[model samples]
Target chain A: MKIDKQKFPDTDGFFGEYGGKFVPETLMYALEELEDTYSKLKDSEDFKKEFYADLSDFVGRPSPLYYADRLTKHYKSGKIWLKREDLNHTGAHKINNTVGQILLAKYMGKKRIIAETGAGQHGVATATVAARLGLECHIYMGAEDVKRQSLNVYRIKLLGAHVHAVDSGTATLKDALNEALRDWVTNVDDTYYIIGSVTGPHPYPMIVRDFNSVVGFELIDQSKALFGRMPDAIIACVGGGSNAMGAFYPFIDKKETRLIGVEAGGNGVSTGEHAAPLNDGSPGVLHGARSYLMQDEVGQVKDTKSVSAGLDYPGVGPEHSWLKDIGRAEYVAINDQEALDAFHTVTKLEGIMPALETAHAFAYLDHLPKDFDESTNIIVNVSGRGDKDINTVAEIDGIKF
Target chain B: MNRLRKKLDHLISIKEKALVAYLVAGDPDLDSTLDLMHLFVKSGVDIIEVGVPFTDPIAEGPIIQKAHDRALKNNISLPNIIKLVEDFRKVDDSTPIILMGYLNTFSFHKELIDKSDQHGVDAVLVVDIPGELSISSYGISNPNIDSISLISPTTSQERIEKIAKNGSGFIYYVTLRGVTGSSNLDVEEINSNIKKIRSYSDIPTLAGFGIKSNEDARLLSEYSDGIIVGSSIVDMITKQSESRNFDRIGEYLRGLKNAIL
Candidate 1:
């Protein structure tokens, strides 16, 4: 089945059977307005020039695709290359989407910007862009995440954005998302919701994916320039599937490069505590989009536990669901312990302290197919830095300070 | 005809405003909810909107969200709520019952929704799948069960026409620009939007969201066919959950009902 990667989310915003405008009537107009305006601006030369210039100058774009010599030797199978999205401004690929969205907010003449965050990387990125653009920004994060990722919270606050600590329903990513949606519903007229991932209703998943696809497009150029060919496989972590979708979108039609999305496996999938929705959950409507969600028999979203806050969500992006259903991409999970080990190993081997979310992708190196040899070239997306996760790692290591 | 349509027509013929009372089923327990349903009809509630508790009620405010959380914590399921409606029908069959909830709960239990009419449910108001996307879109094609749709202050004229045309039973006109339980009733806005909705279709438009106080009910009922009070009533149920004495809730319901009449 040759799927047209470009002709997705057909007008009504459905990626196959997933992704639709499953929101309240109040938000329908706002989404339609956004859709209309985005359609006009997305292809305009002015929009492209402004967006690319900002990406190059502000975000330090074209983040190097460095060959991981030590890690490749350690793996003794695939030649590992790292797409260093971690090197971008604000220390994550989150800035890439935020920059693009805040630009859209500016063009739309929205006075306020609201977003939901899990790891606080996206929160920090949104705050950074909102500050630069001089827009009123509010970021909703789970109360639990506020404590775990305190550094990023402080960074968001320092960047002049208000942080709302949502204490409802496990007080994590999904709950934060619910709170953010409520805020959007209330302030739909003057506010622009900068959804941090490729999830949510209609144009949001499409918009976020398009903005972040720069990562994959750049990888295509860098791989050809350095390795003389496309990668054998591309791996990235999926939490609402922003970075992975960004890295995989450009290669969906390129069948030679295998796309793999690593989900957080908390204890394990069998424990019913992990956040790997595509791997373990069923198809259901959640957070305004029909996607794979970790829900129970009665359709109540189940609680998900993960060491990484970013990957601790019960849902993934809808496009990933479509990709998985079509067998265009492979979905897998990495347990917390394995991710932690990879965090330490990657830091020691490559001197690159990967975020726990990013570490999940690196951890999959050990599980690569035995057929992969030195001739196989694999690129893993370092989606974010670990500076925000230092405290979490320290507590797990029993180092209180 | 569905009970909801028949009741709405009867109310309109008599020039009496409809009072739609909303409560979370199984908040205290399903038995209490059944009792409350009886009590609401006794207090002149023309219709009953039973909230089917979901894990995430995004369109709800803190009051109703908490009510949903409480009901869910009590281990309430769609089947349990459907059974509650069945039990309610054993005593009272005149007051139309509408299952109000997010789409996931109803979509997940298509079998239950398929037989909801026989079980005494007249309509379903799914918060997520609004407009042209009805309960039938989920494959639960029960012609006897009406799919209620919402029209808000932010809804455009074009959308109002589409939503009002697609909807059945009643057009829920959200009184405010916010979620359920949000404050500030724009009477003029409500009048205009409801009039706009009525222009599109003859379906009865009921004003809801932030409809507290008899004055709000009186003012909103002047424009629309009826008023739907949710958060304030849910708040009352939460306060009186311990004693299970719903006298104040009944009094409040009667107060709004009299104001509308």
Candidate 2:
């Protein structure tokens, strides 16, 4: 019974099973003129005082929710908690869905933005929010990811932007998302595009999972002020599942935490090798909707061997396909020589080097659930920064040059 | 007052004669791709396209690139072909999906082609960027999202008015130089290059590569405005995977989409 974006309003977000205006009727009057200028700039108190003074003086939210206390004394009873989002501002969590889609592309006046990357971390976070809101950027990677992320393609060309490279197909990141959807269907009137993940279509997976639900609404206000408690388990690493549904949709009505996710099981999931798409995928209907993929028997979309070019993608995330068909998220699998043996065991035990898509949540820390030994805490969501995978992890551990 | 008169304003109040089908999404898997897109939109198929499956389609041939390498040996990406056109727009939200792949799988995903205009997808052809170049050779905007473009038979007439003022859905015209499923159906030079792209724009100009029967979609839908077939329905699913008699090739593509509508 999905149809409920305020009862099929039909601005762009449909709601049948549930909805999908599926975008591009030449930006259907620029997304119905930015949903009528975000419903009259939500009672414009000067656009919420310049959107919370640029969300607390330009992109620095309430970040840290730390306490890994050395990976939680070997899960003695489980109290891990890390949610750093690799300390935001372009290092990861793709700049909280690129500062709310570049302030809805500067309230739809749209003076050019267009994105698409693979490991140039969301085209250097949409070229650092189109260079602090002045706008005019470009991106689109995959001439083999601008020659394997040449320093995030020179940090999206030192934040001025205009990158290109593409060379089409297997050049990578799904051909820089088909050349930023053929440059937003050939410049859908000015340009803004942005989509880096949480897969695509439908109000961009609910606006990049509501701008990465400010990382699970500040991990439920810092886990109810440090252990008055909630997360008995949450974990992350889903790729295209927008930092695992922005750290699992504000604790999805907290049903005793324990959620998980992981995926990417490349070289495992029985030698079909892995990008574990919702635990060895099946559901079908790729790219637009209907989830769980890693295809074959004829429904195409297969090449996913995940050395984690952002979890390589075959498919996953229609709300993680409605949280794995309503079990409230559990899906697993973590292969590719166990995410390169948890990326060389979390860079020689915690110096960090994480992002091989957070090495599939540290290769499923010995298959979760051990129950209340040290007061069960767990959170995970680390999200990025293995410094663009140090030359494919020093040439897959053989280490040279 | 133009863009194909507002894309046939919900098809000129059902005037008729506009069938168009074309396939290729995960080939034979995504649950026979949601039962061959619900028997190609209940066999009326007023526009479906889909395809996607690429590896190196380069103007395709060899049985639609072996049904696109059996749907990319089952990894069919372009966001799993726009999540199968946003799950067939939750059971057909007024037909019209379109997508046709390559151009580096929709340029990787340009925010899933501006979120495939909310997934009911009205158009996007690609097959090696052919015309107006979608906003000067790839910049994409989305005035409801249509980009079609494929002018061959060795395109000219001064590159069909610069690929018909940079194409925007309603001009594919290839008629055979070779590839897609070439057996060759040049039909008097495809009705003389669709009467020379209907002398530049009034838009609607279809015609795909090596079409194949119901007299090649009634001899290229009586000189264009329809006919895109695709390696004869991927050579009837490679003769239903070499005759295990797969549901009699969905009753031979419901007898070629009811003998080309």
Candidate 3:
């Protein structure tokens, strides 16, 4: 299983079992040509200048680290701050990775940016980047997800991406993933699979983290600017574990900032009603890499149920799994009802209607101790705006206000 | 000899092609599964592949999916599969029985696969797992049970060599690139792959995936050592089960006995 991980270059872009330049015997010459070009182009001053310039002006340079004073007041403890990724373009932290992948895609001379989305957030983010870059975009969505998340369907299409409704198998996220994989296998020549999360093969997690690490990069500066020091802890929600990874990566080197990952505890983790795979699962390989997974006793992956459609999954990102195993970060679960309660709590008490997915971190208040200090600045990644989830939440339970 | 080893070895020594039969365990009902299994062995089946239905069967065609849904609706559990195997052992013990399904369904039923030597199930064929990965590595820790692998016509010769070297019981060479039950095969490609497999290793190659009609089975029988028919037989039983003709399905299976032998 680890053999495949060994195929790639020793963190320098090798592909064999670690990773291969083994794209296709046909494209071998083209890829070799591209790699040679990339070596010279990668660290060129113009490349960095254009990339960082676009990131700040267009993609929203520095997402704020706003002190969530209300959460602190309610908990009657440590001061809480929210890294407002919700304020970024395309509504989630997905753009951070999408922006970088698109730039990398452009540098590779790839014409089409194809992606797979679960809750449709990543697809929209990728499509937004594709449109801005004047590249063709394709989004693969399971037919069932298309029906459930029709609004996201509209959002992706409005961004000018073609959505292929994956009707095979369970007609959900996994099927969408298979279709995306099929597309990659078929169109490897001209297409770049802009995976939304820090999952899929290799280079993806490493590169996506590099793009997303911007959050952690900004958090340190934001934390220092406001409190004259880095926060004691950083928290974020994990679907495929990208947003949490982005918020946690830079701080991984800084041992003081304890990292907490909140997975969607759908109905409940004990009830097997959540997508808290890392918390409840054991080590296994899926989508070409070893990671913690929600496999049945047969060791076959099982369907995970989470209140947040976004976090409902059977696997975790490889890096997140590694982090959990190494004890650098703690992966925890917050179930459907608890996330919903947190959603309402944050909305009413803090006037911020969090995405049902993001409310998982808010639900951590149940587990965290009540006493904290002003110096113990806690940063929670508000990964997305909740407008898209409002209607889905209303469909679940009726509310007057 | 082990049940799987005996079946393949028996056929190899006899200079006769093996006829491997397949059925979804607990389809329609558990009782019917037992009756169908017995009927399968009686009708010249050298070995049986008991399909353990799963929630997501990406490798299955429409026919098998329906059987899986019916089996799941009947509340078939992993224990039921073992119970079926145990019950089958009460009458007959010579015919090898291989438990075939997805890895999820198999992993949950590992205790059963572990006790397969005791229960008389000789091997397990998890349809979804590619040969590049091992059964034990995937958490199916039992060393006693043989892990059957499927090699498609689409699979490269190098891959065939790898699967053949590792595969025990028999090599299930899927006749088509598409899922089971789909028709219109390349008989030439089928024979070439089998010939290719023969060149690589001595593992007995069993052709399946689209072998439905007797003519189709008879045709594939010429190239491969064994034939496996799944969806067609399961579909026939399910169609008859709708009219409450459970016995008629068994009778119908009798008609296809010539297809295998």
Candidate 4:
């Protein structure tokens, strides 16, 4: 129950048999340099001050922990509290990590930054930071995503970042990730790979999680101030699980609090179209670390379909896999239709338009037991706003946006 | 040591650089892959690297990526590639065959190492495994199969030493700063790095990536013990698929060999 977050990754950056450096030989040094610099700077007061200053001034930190009274009325059992990361600058919690990494990049003397994104929130956030820092930025996005999320492509370009439409391997997040890695490998000297999630190899999962843990840290303080006690459970949608890791990490040592991760079930888990790796997949090494993945018998990563581009990945963060195996956290799935319904429900009830990805976590409320303790408060991470997803949602709903 | 070591040692004794050739096992077709393997040997390839096709190969450039797509279209899997090596071994067993691929393919086929060794696979070169990581850690290693580790331009000297220590068959010195098939090689930098690698371990170092012409191969062979050509051969196969002038592959490989010698 007592988890020492510092001792984790045990020098090699592993979380139990999960996270390890599974990158090319060319990237080992860059990761090592990052690991060294991050380790030294993370605990420094100066770094914390800068990060907090940015959070307060730029990202609008201390995102409110608002009570979803109507949603709780519909659920009938538990009181639901929403961690409004969707309220942050760039309309998502992704800015938290990008800001931290771009600062680290500047410190490391990296003049160029590269990133890969699925839903475009991370891409937009990364572009925003790179633009603010005046660093050369390149975002690799799948060609299919480029077509579906043209607005985000335009947004990234407008931020002065070049968007490379990747056409390899299903033309989705995984393919874009491969292309980004290729770009990183080719330009390791002057380029900083700003991985948008807590997934990549070693320090990335640790670093991204730490950078975003500001969300949970803020939640802890605000929850005590507003609710008189910590919430009984914390919930977040897990794509590569950056937001979930951010929210759950601060509570890792809080033994009494429950952590639930919701995954995109797509059509349904049985139909094999889901991105619910933790719920229905097996342990395998993917991207750069050992994690739960939607891979076939031969270890070939399977194609995943989800209504939300952010949750359409075949792999989950390595720490989530470790947490799942150790029985420290619970994971469940929400289907696309259920998420859409929740999207509509949250928008109508709370007047808060939830990103389709965040809707998965909101959708989990409908599945909670009716006899569950009414006194226990549940905090769901509304990780992003739905502005970027408006077109996709509109087209699906037969509304021409 | 295995056949790869033996082949390298033989080449060294004869004062010739080992000309290593790489080809995806099921590119174009399985039958063509079979023919290509023999052609590589007859055309003076000291070692033949057979790529097992997978849906995603991150380290590859556009040429090999397309080759993998073509190979996968014909339903090529790890077992079938190992079988292709088995078939290659039937007629000629002297030329070393290194099964090159990603870690997932090797890990998926549970008995890949045993199968590769039993079928006379001389070594294995997994693109993702850096020197610090071990193939044995994933339960993939065999005495019969020398696990080749890669050293890149960005690889620190400390890691180069570490990789050279663990590396078996040979240390593959990626001559370029990027993925496979990428252009731009600083031969002087590669020569110096190879020296650093050789300082740590006596494992024969081979230069690869962007060795397009016979001149490039000959130029690189002077600094390292051997050379490995991937994109050039894969590109030839792709262009010659319509020509079906598969002999051109042999001719090009022979040209690389003659230049190195």
Top-TM-score candidate index: 1
Q: What is the TM-score of chain A in candidate 3?
A: 0.90
Selected candidate, larger DockQ, 1 vs 4: 1
lDDT for each residue of candidate 1 in B1-261, tens digit (9 for 90 to 100): 989999999999999999999999998888889889999998889999999999999999999889888888899999888889889888888789999998888889998899989999999999998676788888988889999988888888888889889899998988877889989887888888888888889889888899889998999889989999999988989899999999998899989999998
Q: Name the top lDDT candidate.
A: 1
Q: Model 4, which residues run further than 4 Å from truth?
A: none
Estimated TM-score for each candidate: 0.99, 0.35, 0.77, 0.98
Candidate models: Cα lDDT each: 0.93, 0.69, 0.75, 0.89
Worst 10 contiguous positions by lDDT, candidate 3 chain B: B248-257
DockQ of each: 0.87, 0.02, 0.11, 0.78
Order candidates by TM-score, high to low: 1, 4, 3, 2
Descending-DockQ candidate ranking? 1, 4, 3, 2
Q: Give the CAPRI class of candidate 4.
A: medium
Q: Write one digit per residue (lDDT tens) for candidate 3, span A1-401.
A: 11232222344342222222212112223334444644565578987787677778877879877877778888765788888888888788888888777777888889987898888888889889899988999999988778767888999999899999987655777667756765654455687778788775555666677678888889988888999987888888998889998888877777778899998887787887668888888765455455677876655567778767678778778778767766788988888888888998898977888887889988887677455565577888999878878767887787434
Residue A197 CA displacement from its true place in model 2, Å: 7.6
What is the per-residue lDDT of model 4 for residues A256-358, given as tens digits with 9 covering 90 to 100? Answer: 7889999999999999999999988988777788888888877778899898899999999999998899888899999999999999999999999999999
| lDDT, model 2 | 0.69
Q: Give the higher-TM-score candidate: 1 or 3.
A: 1
- Chain B structural similarity (TM-score) per candidate: 0.98, 0.31, 0.92, 0.97
Report the alpha-carbon TM-score of model 4 versus the true structure: 0.98
Error of 1 at A181 (Å): 0.5
Error of 3 at A253 (Å): 3.6
